[model samples]
Target: MVDKADKTAKVAPAKVKGGKKTSPAEFIRQVQTEGRKVVWPTWPETVRISIFVFIMMIILSLFFLGVDSAFGAVVSWLLTLA
Candidate 1:
């Protein structure tokens, strides 16, 4: 039977076989290659996203303001009853 203790045990990170390190130039080259693979949004897409974000922010702020005002009124009325 498989041991439950072994199933729950944490595995350690594997060590480098030869302890070889990458040079700074090689690291920068790898970074540039990875950066090139990234897809960036166009100007119109960016502007549309920014407008959508601002609209949602205004809507959420108004919603929270109404909710806070209702709660404040309820608490104020409750205090008067005591």
Candidate 2:
């Protein structure tokens, strides 16, 4: 069972074995390949995301503004009562 478990464990590739180092060009190519595999948002998807973020920002701003105004009014009213 222990031997079977060891064999089933995922192992990292020994890319840098024996102190062999990666060159800058090889690193850049690896990065480019990984970037190509990324799922980039389409133009329409990006626009929709931006609009959703903008609307949420506006709503939260208004909510905080109202709360601040209410607190200020309460403080002013307390000062008048004194």
- lDDT per prediction? 0.94, 0.94
Mark the 10 consecutive residues where model 2 has the least summed lDDT: 12-21
Off by over 4 Å in 1: 1-7, 14-23
Best by lDDT: 2
- The best candidate by TM-score is 1
Tens digits of lDDT, candidate 2, 18-79: 76898899889999999999998999999999999999999999999999999999999999
lDDT of 1 by residue, 2-81 (tens): 99999999998665446667778988998999999999999999999999999999999999999999999999999999
Q: Which segments of candidate 2 are over 4 A away from where they belong? A: 1-21, 75-82
